[model samples]
Target: MTEAVEYDVVVLGAGPAGENIVDRTRAAGLSTAVVESELVGGECSYWACIPSKALLRPALARADARRVPGLAEAVAGPLDAEAVFAHRDYWTGHWKDDGQLDWLESIGAHLHRGHGRLHGVRTVAVTGPEGEHELLTARHAVVIATGSRAVIPDLPGIHGARPWTSREATSARHVPPRLLIVGGSVVAAEMATAWQALGSQVTVLVRGPRLLPRMEPFAGELVAEALREAGAVVRTEVTVEAVVRDGSTGPVTVVLEGGEPVEGDELLMATGRSPRTEDIGLDTVGLTPGGWLDVDDSLRVVGHDWLYAVGDVNHRALLTHQGKYQARIAGAAVAARAAGGSAGAGGVDTGRWGAHAATADTAALPQVVFTDPEATAVGLTLAQAERAGLRVRAVDHDLGKVSGAGLYADGYRGRARMVVDEDRQVLVGATFVGPGAAELLHAATVAVAGEVPVPRLWHAVPAFPTMSEIWLRLLETYRG
Candidate 1:
């Protein structure tokens, strides 16, 4: 017999996306249930973002000490990778998903700690950790918030090879002596930086012309240079043909297409990630081409109407914050639907706000790469704007020329660029690269999101002797 439970909404995957929806739905007086197979906080909290950043902090501090005058001599020893892993473990609350579980319970959201699959259009069946079987039928909606998995390329000798993904790279106990990273995406660049700083001889093979090709060309150039400066041998514009393990003594040898073969002790594949839409019973509902659940403007899965897709499953931007945003909207939509209120109540379109909805993300999504000299970017680049047929003007400034940047380190060299709509004089995009630029991105994000006018932004003073003073210098350079 199927043990059935009812809810206003049943969210599959209690990651950040599902949790956000559960919290918001309960707040709106709607019954919500979340199902999970692993950590409640999801990938970013456990492996991707939090743990990776924790591993990078020591490298950042060491870099700061090296560059900051009077601080270089005070620093005594090298970073201990073991100690860093211990600290990462501590910050992750020691691998017990208890903290997140407690939060879910406190929020009045029922959690089924098991694998969940779609049984019907609005039904989810769960096999709990304790050998309990449960069926959940959502009176309002069933949301698929299952995230994505790292992509491993099909290369020779990849089989029987102990390759690392973002998960392994972020959680490994010990760093390998030599690491070969395939792909030039943010993950590849970041892992290269982190492992190289932690005493790994790193080499990155990229098929693109430059690293981070999706970013501004200047930013990509800067990142490439930074990787070389950090002792990473970066091979660009080369396709990888084969990766084979060298007998026993030499490192893993990776042969490039029309290029020389390079060797490393470990091969970390950072090709990319694919949406995890398989085996969750998406076919029970219906899936679009490319395995994405068909969703409408209101985040409703087409045909079924009550079904929705959120997070990476929707095949939208695979970002943690964006997924949470989708969840909040989905929760609100469910509550609105249950209240007999039109999604158009109070001029608020619940559809515009909920499951699989990433309206704001399209306009204000931000990306940051925690490289040695961190890189942060938001919105369209100059080329992107031009490609979109918008008239844009760009102004750039060097970090060393900014007073705030000067105080942070003796030989600060970084670039800050803003793309502006020539007519409205509002920023469309911004990129900042160099030490301390990661923290400087939010101000730019706020400016872009608010569509703050350039003249009005001039009055927004940056604190003196801070990295953000580059904003003022950038504006000045633009005016000059």
Candidate 2:
């Protein structure tokens, strides 16, 4: 028999975005239910973000220890892959999905274990482990937090060949002797670093001119240099025309566009991802042309009043953090509506602040690439700012001068660039590339988000001898 359930709000996919939404909704005094098929914590915790970084951290630690003369002798060589996996398991709590479930229960959110599908405008059907369960209606909203899946590129031999995606790369128990990476994105760079540190010779083939092309040129240059220094063969403006297994050598031989053959023990495709909207019954309600659930500024699906989309499913920013931000807003908006408030009342403004119905994503999205030398950036590129018709001034600073960089290594090489709206005196964008730059991004994020003026930011002060002090240097360079 089909079971009937009711929820003020039903969130599908308990990822960072979905979790944040439920958290905020419960705080607003709304009854919510979350449905998840896999691990409750979503991709960030188990697969994509967290685990990948875990694979890289031991490498980073080894590098750090080798830099300090006193610590160098005591520090062991590269991290053992087994030990790294053990540590990663501990961080992920051994992939226990129950921890996230408990958190949802503690927060007064109901959990449905199954795949969720939209049945109608205000209805969701859950096929749980037990039987057919129907969530009759959302008194307020139904959120689609279904994340994304990796996009597999087309190559002549790629179909038959077994290639690793982010999932396999992050969770692999052992490293291959040689690796060939397909894409030039941040994921490719990160995996290249982790595998290389674990004793794999890596060759990265990028279809684009530079790694992390989304960041500033200075930032990309620093990472490219770091990768080359760490013994990676970085190739740009190249395409993998074909791939085949060499039985004699037991390696995958990849042929580039012009018939140049590159061989590796393993192949990793870090091309990109596509929204997971194919099977979730978007057609049961309605879907847009690009396989997206079209949503307004508030993340409310257009035409379907109670259906909302969040996270990667919405086809917005792919970062887990950004997905969480969108989820929080969508959850709040739905809860408000359920509580007899207008769907748009006091809800986050999607326009000025990426509020629902807001198309201002490019203005303030933060991205970080955790390579040997990390790369972090937020907001528009100089070209983007100019295209938007804003008068922009950009300043680039060598991070070697910063106390933070000095502490990182005896001979430090890093770069920092900031784009300011000359008239507003507010940062339109910023990029930092070097060791420990990932931690340095929040100050810039806050500056851009808060619209802190250059002079005022100078007054805020970064602590002495910290990588954050580079902010002062950047500001000084801008003045000069």
Candidate 3:
């Protein structure tokens, strides 16, 4: 039987972004319905962020201990991969969404488990799992938070080999003896870090000159060095000519350009991601299906006033934290627009970091790659700041030179860079690489997002005998 439901907001996916939007609108007294095709928590919870981080933590802990002489002797041993797998399974809830679904319900939002598509503006038609159909109408807005999927390059015999995508790589119960990972993004680097630690004879083939090409060149170099130090083989400037497998569950033979064929029990394609907009019926609404949707600073679809694309589908910034940040802005905007952009009637302020504007998406995008050396950066690189025509100077400091850093480890190895716009005298970017560097990223995020001037940053002193003191060093260097 067909059913119909209506709400003030109809969200298409219940990932971090969708869930947050629902929370915001519900807080504003709007009725919300979130339709999800898979587990309510989506990729990060089950596959990408949660499970991968859970798997990486033990390895990172072991690595950190090894760098400290006293701790090194205490923890010189292989990580129990099975125990780590158990921990990862627990974090993923064994691929269940009961907890996430409960949270949505508690927030007074409706939930529908099905494939949702746009039937028209502010209207959605969903096909449920058992072939049931439901029509959802939104009086205010329709949101596309469908996120993205890993892209596998087309090559001969690739499909026959049944290669693993991120889902398989992050959630696999057992480690393959020999693993070949393709691509050079965060997924490839982090997974290689985890699986190799779990005792896989791992080889990473990157089609580019370096891994993490999007970040500062040094971040990739440091991570690659750490990976090699951890006993994982890192190969760059390579291409897979073809692939062949005798059986679906058998080993894959990957032929490289002008090299010997490489065999592995599994191949993980971490190439990149394409938005999951293809089957969501964008054609019904005169939008191109299977392509990234464009949106304004308020997250509203460019031409469609009542349609908003938040998170990965919009192609603003693919990181989960960035998506959640956009969701907050978009959700507040949706509510305020519903109320004539006025206050006193559940409206919002649209100022920079006020209530509705998403200014930080462009001015400041903070990311932390949880690799061994922990590459964390916010805002633009030195090249990007210069290319933007901003009068910027990059100040760098050797983290090992810091007294606090040396005390943190026996032989501390890390680097920090802060890009300051000379005219404004404010930091426009920051990058930190080393063990325990992730802990210092939030300060940089705050500096860039708030556009704190370098002079004022000096007054905002970092606590001594802490990794955060690097901020003092950076500020001092700029002053010098």
Candidate 4:
């Protein structure tokens, strides 16, 4: 007989989103149970964000040091690959989830270590590793925070070729000697930067015209230039037709269209991501299987009053931070509804930018690509603003010209752009591409999210002799 359990809230997937949901709901005195098939901390903890950033930090630091006058000679030699790998391992807790488990236990949420699927409305069936079956029924709501997986394209001989996804790229112990990357997204660019700095012959194949196609065009241009200067090949407008591998462990050859075949020890296909909803039994709950869940601002699944979807599974915003934001809103909404109060109807603010709404996902979605020249942006691009039918003006300034930028690095090269809503004279979007530019993003995020007027922003002073001074230069450029 299957063991049956009950809880006020059942969360599927113990990722950052699911964990945050548990944090909020459990705090509100809701009996919560979280289910996970893998480690408690999920992808961002074990593979994607933490490990990737851990691996990239040393490489970025070395690159930054090389730009400083006296420090350039000190870091002229190659990085210690083994030391870097050890650092990455340390950050990921050596791929052990004990620390995460302790945190969950501290929060007083029941954890079901198994693959959980929706059995029906407010119900879940968990299958443990030993084939142990357990049924979980929720008294309030069932939340799906199962994240996403890498999508490897169906190319000839691809499966047998054994390409690395974002998981393998970030977690691999040793760097490939000749690494061929297949896409130009954040994962590809970052891995290329990482592996090349670790003494690999990295070649990036971009089907699109440039890298980081999502950000401003100049961002990609600067990163590509830096990659080429660092002895890595950045090829654009290239397509991979097929892949060939000799054995289970052998060098792979990529057959390209209208170009010479490129050979490499390993290939990383950072093509895209698909929601991890295929096996979650959505079909049992009157929803299509393997589909992105659609949710309202409150993160409650549309047409399903008892179902909620957070994180990448909902397709709102794929960033880990954004997923956490949605989780907070969803957790509150679930708690409110359980108290016989509608999210917006019962003294809860569900209006735009309210506590019960995830307004920042669209208004001020922030992202930072940790490359040699970090590309950070909040809100929309100029084209995006124009597409949204906003009367906008894009103000540009050369980051290299700023006093703080020159002081930060010799021959500093980067750009900054602020998109202003003309009628309102407030920043709707901003992009900063340069060294330590990630630190500049939050100010931009606040300006966009708060809709602070340009005249009012002039009064907000940026500290001198810091990369943040770019803000003042940007405002001055706008004025002129």
Best by lDDT: 4
Provide the lDDT at 440 for model 4: 92
Candidate 2, residues 277-334: lDDT per residue as tens digits? Answer: 7777777775742376667767888887788888888777888988887777776667
Best by TM-score: 4
lDDT of 4 by residue, 1-480 (tens): 276799999999999999999999999999999999999999999989999999899999998898999889988888998999999999899999999999999989999999999998999999998999999999999999999999999999999999999999999988788999999999999999999999899999999999999888999999999999999999999989999997989999999997579999999999999999999989998999999999989998899999999999999889999999999999998888888886446756679988889999999999999999999999999999999999999999998888888988999999999999999999999999999889999999999999999999989898888888888888988999
Q: Write the per-residue lDDT of candidate 3 for residues 254-310, one digit (tens) a residue.
A: 899996698999999899999999999899889999999999888888899899998
Give candidate 1's total backbone clashes.
4
Candidate lDDT values, in order: 0.82, 0.81, 0.90, 0.93
Where model 2 places Cα greater than 4 Å from the true spot, the runs are 1-3, 130-136, 246-249, 288-290, 343-351, 354-360
What value does the lDDT take at residue 170 in candidate 1? 90
Segments of candidate 3 deviating more than 4 angstroms:
1-3, 342-354
Clashing pairs in 4: none
**C-alpha RMSD values across all candidates:** 2.4, 2.3, 1.8, 1.1
TM-score of each: 0.94, 0.94, 0.97, 0.98
Order of models, best lDDT first: 4, 3, 1, 2
Candidate 1 or 4, higher lDDT?
A: 4
For candidate 4, give the lDDT: 0.93
Question: What does candidate 2 score on TM?
Answer: 0.94
Error of 2 at 140 (Å): 1.3
